[model samples]
Target: MASIDMDAFAADWIAAWNSHDLNRIIAHYGSDIVFLSPIAEKLMGNGKVAGLDRLRRYWTAGLASQTDLKFELLHVLRGHECLTILYRNHKQQIVAETLEFDGDGKIQRAFACYQLEQG
Candidate 1:
């Protein structure tokens, strides 16, 4: 497998999130991808979503809910076929996502965690 430029990918990924363009953001994932996030349960009625269609629905709802959504990338850790990204959301939530890529360099599976601030 060809090495992916983590920096470049991170830049584009951040741009896509900041753009709030679902198509652009989803372009990084594979059709059969599986995504797991805590927010997914609230948005999609489940903590895990599979396939592009479901992912689209979940992401659409998320974007609609957050009108001022923006991702501030903090760090990136690269693996053989995966990348872990640390970022801050518009709501001041710190998020970490691990993405596992397919042979085609598309994200096949992703897991997200968030650090919620205590009041």
Candidate 2:
């Protein structure tokens, strides 16, 4: 398998999110991927979403809720088999997502953290 470039991946990831294209964003993950995010709980009543089907539902709901969503990439940290992406949302919240890649270079597991800014 070929090596994955974290910087390039980060760029594409941000673009995919900013585009609000669920299919484009989901394409980065494996079919059996597990994603953990607080937003998932708020949207799907669960903090952890497993499998592509559930992930698609969760993301579709998110895209619908945040129609003008955009992600501004701040940093990209690369590890042996993981990548940490730091970005600012349209709401100006700082979000960080750490993704672990499968053997095929698809994201197998992902965790997201963010704190919304106070008005």
Clashes of each: 0, 0
Clashing pairs in 1: none
TM-score of each: 0.95, 0.94
Candidate 2, 26-49: lDDT as tens digits: 999999999999988887788999
* lDDT of candidate 1 at residue 56, scale 0 to 100: 95
User: For each candidate, what is the lDDT?
Assistant: 0.91, 0.90
What is the C-alpha lDDT profile of model 1 across 1-119, one tens digit per residue? Answer: 25788879988999999999999999999999999998898766789999999999888988998999999999998877899999999989999999999988899999999997799
For the record, the alpha-carbon RMSD of candidate 2 to the native fold, in angstroms, is 1.5
Prediction RMSDs, each to the true structure: 1.1, 1.5
| Top TM-score hit | 1
Candidate number with greatest lDDT = 1
lDDT of predicted model 2 = 0.90
Give the Cα error of residue 62 in candidate 1, in Å: 1.0
After superposition, the stretches of candidate 2 with alpha carbons farther than 4 Å from their true spots are none
